[model samples]
Target chain A: MSLLWRNVFGQKTGDDSLAGFLGSIPLFAEMKPRDLRQLAALVHPRDYDDKETVFSEGDPGSGLYLIRNGRVKIFTRDSSGHEHEIAVLEAGDFFGETTLVSPAVRTASARTLEKSQLVGFFRADLLDCMEKNPRLALRLLFGLTRAMSERLHLADRELKRLHHALHELQAEGQD
Target chain B: MAESNGLTRGHVLLFFLVMTASIASGLAIFSSASRITELLHTATTGIVLPVLLALVLSFLLEPLVRLFERGPLTRTASIFLVFALVASGLYLAFSWLSPHWAEMWFSLRTDLPRYLGRGIALLKEAQARVQEIFPYIGGFDLPSRGRVLAERLFSHILAQTTGSALKIGGLMVLVPLFTFFFLRDGQKIVRASVGLVPNRYYEMAHDLAWLISRQLSQFVRGRITEAAIVGLVVGVGLSVTDIRYAPLLALFAGITNLVPYIGPIVGMIPGILIAMVDLGIGAQFWWIVVVYLLIAQVIVDNFILIPILISHVSNLHPLWVIIAIIMGGKLYGVLGMIIGVPVASILKIVIIEIRYYRQTFALPLGEFDS
Candidate 1:
């Protein structure tokens, strides 16, 4: 009976499997082992075929998806219908973190590069976690805030570099 | 232009076919409603009601279980603890209230015929006085009509009571058993169900399920709390005012309050009738009882209980609520009337979400064209 239950619902106990995988992700790095187990219980594992769309660019974003195995391409289409590649994500990488705060439309689409396994952690799940364990919810939010701030710093440096290059190009032209 | 016209004609033909099929199915179901009701009363009651009750109980108790899980307990342990707590609470309440309930029941059984007789006599007197003024109202035989209506209602109640009594033992065993399983494995069950959706529609399907579940849980919790508060206030108010069978009246009022628009009025009828019988129509005490019921059920319930507890959960239009209650009553009697508003609200949500998804995607409705 226990074996059948495990086969049907998958093994949910023990911190060495899904909980460990979740802890390896930077976003959930701050969570304690017990907290990881709690969050792992809420994670929904999904499988996708190669070239299958995880979500369309304009689709409503609901949650973060962490790749457990295989590759996913995150891309957006131009106004004239040109697909521009943003990133190729593999195992341990997560996307759609912005939706944890609110359900907004996806700015980019994601599709599997190969047959893939993914784990979804939705906004509703997070809200429920907050009710059940506020401390864990606080740690998650802190991790999310840190990740966003790092991205912001990188973008600011890139913008400054671009501005300097434009000035140098103007100086050369004038000479 | 010719091709466009052909496409338009085909769309029109398809639309008409779909509409005709829907109407035919509706008519067929309507015609077979009596047979369906009979089957439901016999077989379905023994099976379906237990499952339904279990589902409602699990939804109501899930938050508490989650709360307990946050402590030093596993999910399974938390569920068991919740069950134990609820059982203990119910046992205590039963012990405390059982004697008072028995006394109330005995008095009500003894006083019912007198109340009915006096109520009929009062109605006959009113009919005569009205006829003296209007003359066209003569020969109405109001008492006989009232008696017939009363007889039908009594027989219906008796039949329903017998049916429910037979099923109580089964319900006692099944409801808790089903509830325990649901509380323990609800997440696994939901995940397994959602796991079957194709990758393309997975997120949409998941979101829709979550939305529907949230809506139902919120509505159920709010309704139960509102009913309890209304019952308590009405019970205490009547108890202080020399009213007979205050607890029984309050219980009826609480149960009836599950139905929207018409529930409070239905709840007040017996109280009003008893008051008239006891204090004589137009007496000061009778008028006070009438005013108190009005204030308790109408003013307090509408202004306080609904606004605080239920308004946000349902948010259904008054007209739609009335229509749903009437249709529900016509189909499934009192239970239908009670569930009518929530069911309508759910349908409204589904329709709105489907329309929104269709517009947002602009994909062909026939298949996942993208």
Candidate 2:
């Protein structure tokens, strides 16, 4: 509660806290404090209890959520209703960014692994900020595109490996 | 800290502060009532009205500006080019119509009393005819209020010409200046305003803004087209029938069409009166003008114009449109009535969007939907 601790540790629950947190994110690491402050104003802080569903698969995509603390489970449900964990995301990581580029249904469900805090930056707010500060918007957009491209490349490798495995299983069956 | 019923001393203090602030504001408002009203009036006439008129003009002219910009001209150059074209077009129109307008003006000024006398005499003759048919209806006790209203209506239309012209002239000078800035910075201003929405309802707010902007702009475009077509139709019809001041009546028809429901009736009045005057009561030409206007109103305005142009833009119910016009007229007179439908449409979209979001999203009472 002391000002000294708040200032020195950057643990304040406000613009300064948000700026410090955002500064560590790969996308916003180079952003000026002033610009980050503007971004901070647009972020909505949400608290989640352990095992709470952050979002369900097939739900309409909203925006990206940056994990301020704790962890999240990204998983998918198969036809038989078994959940497959895609990834476990920790603090400083973000998810559900496809909504920023376009309105899309969530491909995976997200749930909190423990008590957590998150900061959401909605698509609409991002677009609005872009109009006001085109340069900053472009930088954020570039970061998003690069992140998505990397994700696609990883997905492509996994898909090809699965295809090879399937062909090999078929050849064994034929022999 | 002290607490009563979960209220802390801090909460009590804040409540009292708010109450004090409210009381102070009320007292201040009451004390400066006259000054506030004067300021409001000045602001409305000087800034709001001119800006609104300029916005409407820009809506009508922006397409032309865009078209010119495609012809290897910068946006500024294109805007200026369109302005120059508009100025020359207005000059040509003025030159062409001046003699007729002057003749009509001369007749109006010199023969207004005579015209009123004739109009009254014609009304009396109709009254006598009705009395003859029903002998129980004796000498008419015409209500003083009705007579005053009739006098006011005519005086307002004919006598206030110069005063209204001066006001319009002032507005004309101011409108272009505001419109230029609006055209140049409209998108940035819009984005800035949209950015003010809270994070929870951010997407909904943006969608609502987009919906309203699209609908309103479409409404404006449709209205301009409707007005031009209606004006041309009325003008050509009147000219064919050899009606006096055909062009002027057509212009009136076009301008008044900006207001929904009541406009066509208002547009038809001067033409009807002129017909009654120029051709004696019960004359053939008078009947022809009446029939022609009826056809135009039915075939043109209601059927063709509304359906093809305006119906899709707002989709405002006729009852709501009427209510909006009445409320708007009461608040802001002519301008309010003209803008009422679009404003109402915007409000409808906002309300609907909010309702939808409330139902779909997890909305706690008194807080934004998430």
Candidate 3:
């Protein structure tokens, strides 16, 4: 009875579309239908208070957090506690994986700029489940890898922009 | 700012790894060095483990610390509150186990003798069988080098084990005691560690260090929480089944399982043997043993332990797991074996971060295929 509601539940209308969209994700393309269903159960849509931290950059992190609605910012804080924006995460975006892959502190903090909703999947929990369902695990692995790769791609772009801005500022100062 | 000297994150990481390896390899290969040097890898980990665990525990309990930090309670009182919680948990755990273990001991005193006799008879019969098959092995007479080897190995093991236990008891006071100080002055430590960085990448490295520290702490916190839950579940299950030594068996299972991969099996052996002894011989006993272990495994693996663990420690590879155990075992023996996997995972992350630093700094250009 405790698990009755959980075992055979259906997502609300918008939530169903979100699940559908996740299925369409190249990262999750490998996940089987049943496995996806299992994952869908855990992917609760959660809202954050504005300026509320989803996770801090230096805080211990596990699982990947995906923006389901609204926006979150990834920013790293210096030792002096100065925050630096790393990326703006919107619907369909994910973060917090660098910690999962490397066991390092998050490189940046994730704060809700607007009222935000995110769905999360902890790596440890999912992997354990994956053992029983390797096909789904493989799909998740693909998704995790892609998720990480996407963040790095974004960080790289940011770094390039910083470099260009620095050069421009240097030229301007000389003039 | 001029025509620049750029260090890529790749270059930084390579230099860091190569340098660290060079130092480590030197120490590992040093023949004339103290036996202590051989344990440096493990001994170093012993120090890091307490500090890291303390930091993580502090972080997880930050809300409580912050709550008390704002309250009428003094810093010392707040710390005492934390320690009291830990102490009570330990006390309650021990209290529950004491009676169960007493029962086990009483039963063990009676039953172990029979099991040993059975084992001895089996060994003697096997020896006789081997005598018929291979004369030389049997020819090695009574009180030969075998006894000496066994005796020496056992005595050495006993001495080392006792020494390690004593050392652990003596020093584990530092873990919670330091944890209290860490929770209180953690910011000071972070500031100091950050201060050591130079003007160049000072900001970046500080961010990274804090992040790294946070990640490691979360992993430990999550593991501890998950382990406790598993232990509680196991204890309840055993109690429900009317199994003997439920507390002791669950305690062992819970604590041993703090170590990944190797722990469950390690914890199970003692419990299985205890169960075997408790049953006092019969097919029914064996069936109970099989079922308890099976159900316990299912609940712990499927529902609890693995799910939580994999979520936190997805960074560690199987190769690293084995290597860490071996390396830890070689150094501090069992403790090293226990702490080695998580430490290795953390270190692996550090290595990757160093690599990330190199690429960011333009320290050197190398293939990214790795």
Error of model 1, residue A48, in angstroms: 1.0
All DockQ scores: 0.41, 0.08, 0.02
Give candidate 3 regions above 4 Å deviation. Answer: A1-175, B1-63, B70-77, B88-169, B240-244, B277-293, B312-315, B352-370
Look at candidate 1 and give me any clashing residue pairs: none
Q: Local distance difference test, per candidate? A: 0.80, 0.74, 0.65
Provide the RMSD of all predictions against the true structure, rounded to 1 decimal: 6.5, 9.9, 19.4
Highest DockQ, which number? 1
- Cα error, residue B332 of model 1, in Å, equals 3.7
In model 2, the Cα lDDT at residue A112 comes to: 89
Interface RMSD of 1: 3.2
Please report how far candidate 2 places residue B21 from its true position, in Å.
10
Report model 3's TM-score to 2 decimal places: 0.49
**Model 1 error, position B347 (Å):** 3.3
lDDT of 2 by residue, B1-370 (tens): 4456799789889999999999999999897997889888877765767877677777787778767665568668888888888889999988998998999877766665655666677677777788889989775554444456667867787767888899888877888888877766665587578768653344456555654565566677888888888888878777866567788888888877776667777888777777778765665466546544665677887788888777453667789989988888887787788777667876776566566555665443322112
Q: lDDT per residue, candidate 3, A1-175, as tens digits?
A: 7477656784544346666756655567667665567567534345566766665544444556777778988877687867788789788777765555444545666778887777665544454445434556666777778867877899999999999999999999999
| Candidates sorted by lDDT, best first | 1, 2, 3
Give the chain B TM-score achieved by candidate 2: 0.77
Please report how far candidate 1 places residue A150 from its true position, in Å.
2.1
TM-score of each: 0.83, 0.65, 0.49
* Worst 10 contiguous positions by lDDT, candidate 1 chain B: B361-370
